[model samples]
Target: MDSTRKYTAEAPPLQEVQQTRGPLVLEFGTSWCGHCRAAQPYINEAFTSGPDLPHHKIEDGKGRPLGRAFRVKQWPTLIFLRDGEEVERLVRPADSASITRAMARIEQN
Candidate 1:
């Protein structure tokens, strides 16, 4: 899958993602969000290092099922998972290091 691709529809069930093999990154935010846009470069840089990692960019807003399930309260929330289990999360990461650190958690698992 395209690491930079953004999903506009509702995200898959958290349980489904959790059950999926390998590492995954669930990114919650809207395309129009300034915070999300600002963090794109860092996010890209981190994920680019692991081209095989699945990065799901889900558009989040009020009443969105997946976002609600994850209890997302901020824009650009990155949830790292391995074997469908949450490994780490970063909200509004300030730099590539922060994103890289989160990605490392998944790699280490």
Candidate 2:
């Protein structure tokens, strides 16, 4: 969808994510987290620039109720959701290849 912009969990009801008929990858991150910051560009580059997947970013902080609901414990956690349910998730990218591969998999489904 080319949503190069970030999204908040509070933006809307999440049930639609699963019912939309395509895949959605939610990124949980915090601003100061080096791993999270490092992964952002890779996500954009991989999805928006390359495969063109519908990507969304959520910040783990007091204002982000959705992050709290997801129980995000670390930075740059990639969660693959299809039909509003979690299908796959990677806590942290071991390397660039793995990160892009994760997104690629999400794009595939």
Candidate 3:
């Protein structure tokens, strides 16, 4: 797990993301989004004790192909993927339990 958490504006292409192996989490949101900001604590807490998987905080907005490819409509959408296929998802998570639960699902696979 990454100790430094921040959303990166430049994200990999949709095709490249789909080709990833093993479990990973994709978090989509802008830096200034309130809902995205509010969810950070929960996200952080989950990662703190959760499995050491690749977690990417991608800055998403207009013209972002990766977000659109995943059909993300809400900020801070956490997509749990195993072998590049989605297993579970959490949107605007309010608690670490929910995020942990979602991570568990993918970790199980």
Best by TM-score: 3
lDDT of 1 by residue, 27-97 (tens): 99988899999998888878777545778899999888888888899999999988888888899988988
Instruction: Put down candidate 3 lDDT per residue, 47-102, tens digits, no spaces.
Output: 99888889888999988889999999999899999999999988989999999988
TM-scores of all candidate predictions against the true structure: 0.89, 0.70, 0.94
The best-first sequence of candidates by lDDT reads 3, 1, 2
Local distance difference test, each candidate: 0.84, 0.66, 0.89
Q: Per-residue alpha-carbon lDDT of model 2 for 3-81, expressed as tens digits?
A: 3465454433455554666667777776677887666666666665455566677766765666666777787788877
Which candidate ranks first by lDDT, i.e. highest?
3
Error of 2 at 71 (Å): 2.0
Clashes of 2: 2
Error of 1 at 94 (Å): 1.1
| Inter-residue clash pairs, candidate 1 | 18-84
Which stretch of 10 consecutive residues in model 3 shows the poorest summed lDDT? 1-10
Better of 1 and 2 by lDDT: 1
